[model samples]
Target: MKIPKIDKTILVHLALFAVALIYGANYTIAKEVMPLYISPSATILMRVLGAAILFWILVGKKRLILSNKREKIILLLSAIFGVVVNQLLFFEGLARTTPINAALIMTTTPLLVLMVSAITGGEKFTFFKIIGISLGLLGAAMLIGSKTVSDSSLPFSFVFDFNLGDLLILLNAVSYAIYLVIAKPLLKKYSALSISKWMFTLALPFVLPFGFSDLGTTNFEQIPTEIYVGLGYIVLFTTFLTYLLNAWALKSVSSSVVGIYIYLQPVLATFIAVALDKDSLTPTKLIWAACIFLGVFLVSRK
Candidate 1:
């Protein structure tokens, strides 16, 4: 049997777009399922468990090699940040915050990536990029300070107490940025599927404990069919498909190209949320979004 080769250029573009689209709509779809029918930890458990099963099914039979002890440790750490903490924080955050805020706050990841890259001496930050990073932070702070769906009565608490959900999501962004940095070297040694499968498998121990109680409490028979569909979307498209597409794209395109596509996520997320009436566009939000977008453009426009 022969697999026909598509043009790598076109396939790369489609893969990038697919990643953005899956992630963009996920804000609302994931929000709809969590807390209402499933706890955040339970959602993380299902997403990883389901995706892990599918990844193994796709490639589990093949033997994978890790070159050294350091690589193995890095793999474990990657699972912690990338799979366990990253997901646990994101779903919990999304449950408390509006989809718009979650999406908007996520735009800060690229900047975090750059800062970590600079700190690790993987890259240098120019003065202009620093300013852009500052502006982006300003925008994020503004967005966090703005009224959220979860805390309309306590707008100022974001500065003092901090909206737990928004804070968790921001932390999730930082963890993801760190995961990107940690996983880069491993990608050079292994295929993405192999690395992803192992990482998620290792993550199960960490994820299961937090989720077990919630899983036990969930009334599966009472859950609506629509929520199940939303969960399927999260497991299949957001987790599984997006990872494959991203890994495939990285083989052909620069990581910077992949990072640039993140800008689309917030836009699509915002549009979907607004259209669904799950979130509304406000003057402050518009102004802050502009700042963040412009800042991200400046920082990312190498």
Candidate 2:
């Protein structure tokens, strides 16, 4: 069957939009399942394994070649940074922080990637990009501030007042930025699905220990069936489908455009949080959302 021609830009944007929506909803989904059936490590492991299996099934008989020792080494390292470490930090951070904070901090990944690229001579740092990144940070700060002010019912004491969840999400952003930079060169040689498969397979070993430990603490028999179903959804949609679509989008569109989509994540996440989880959509959130969106636009614009 012949494939129909599609506008690459439109397809990329659409895919990115879908990814943002799935990612946004994931915050609540993960929160619900993470505490019951899985630990951070286990959740990460399931994601990688599930995604890899799906990729392998789709790729069929076309053998993905590693080429040489150097390529294999690079792939290994890419898996370590991109899949293993990045996911480990992300899930653990999610466990500590609220989804809103996590989503907000994740907006920094693009700026961080740009900085890494500039320092490595992969890309030049432009003034506009700097301004854009600053805008993103300002937006995130506004959102954080709004969240802080709105939740006045809680105690003001330092120990009890602050949410550790946001900090964890920030770590995921940093790790993800590092992964993007490290994985860029490899993408030139391998297809995104191929790269994803190898990375996840290699990451499996590293993540397994954590997954097993989390399982030990939980009573598997006592957990509700819905929690497993939620886990399945996360693995299928958030982990597997989202990653594949993102990889395809990256291949088809400019990285700057792809980066801009990060802003969409928090917006979608907030809506999902409100609609499904019954989280408040406060004025403070709106303010922060504006700041973040402005920052993303500035950073990613030509």
Candidate 3:
């Protein structure tokens, strides 16, 4: 049967929008399982293994790989940065921080993506955008230096007092930004599913040792079934499905458009967190989130 033809522009936007919604829910869904019931290593392991298996099972022998040495290296790098480093840091960070904080911190990815893209010569940075970068940095500093969840803390004391989880999330953002820059060229040479399949397969080896150790200690019977549902969501929707959509979007849109979709993630994440009583929205979050949002707007605007 022939698939109905959709406009490329609409398809790209739809793909990105779906990813943003998935990621938004993911912040809360993922956090509910960490350090409390699952270790970061275990969670990352599940994500990597699940995604790899699903990609292989669903994609099967229909891959369109060139299999050149250069292509292999790019895929390897993408896997390392995109999955291995990104998942490890994000889960570890989420374990230590609240869902809202993780969501807010991830907004910096677009700004970081812009900077990485500029330095790598894939994109040009303007003077207006330089100012935007400054504001974004200031916003990140404010959010990171402050307490994770409270209104009583002094608001002006952003003296580089680091929160470990928040810092790791920032590093995750950096790794992901680099991944986007690295993966852009590969999309031209291969299909998104092809890149994803190889990326996760390559990442599995690097992540195995840590995840294996964590899995050994995990007592499965103690975990509630709801948590399993959450894990299923994380592995299937957040990790697997979202990455596919993101890759497809990246194929058609500029990185700027791709980055713009991220703006919705924190909004959806925050609302879900608040409604579920998983995380609270504080005055500081509002202030810092505003700074980041405004900065993102300036940087992304043509």
Best candidate, TM-score? 3
| TM-score of candidate 1 to 2 decimals | 0.92
Worst 10 residues of 1 by lDDT: 154-163
TM-score of each: 0.92, 0.85, 0.93
Per-residue accuracy of model 2 over 112-180 as CA lDDT, tens digit each: 777767877877867888887777676654443334442477532112244455655666676677666
Task: Give the Å error, residue 30, model 3.
Answer: 1.0
Candidate 3 lDDT over residue span 30-90, tens digit each: 8888888989899999999999999999788785656689877888899999999999999
What shift in Å separates residue 156 of candidate 2 from its native position after superposition?
14
lDDT of 3: 0.87
Candidate 3: lDDT of 242? 89
lDDT (0 to 1) per candidate: 0.84, 0.73, 0.87
Candidate order by decreasing lDDT:
3, 1, 2
Over all chains combined, what TM-score does candidate 3 have? 0.93
Which portions of model 3 show Cα errors greater than 4 Å? 1-5, 148-161
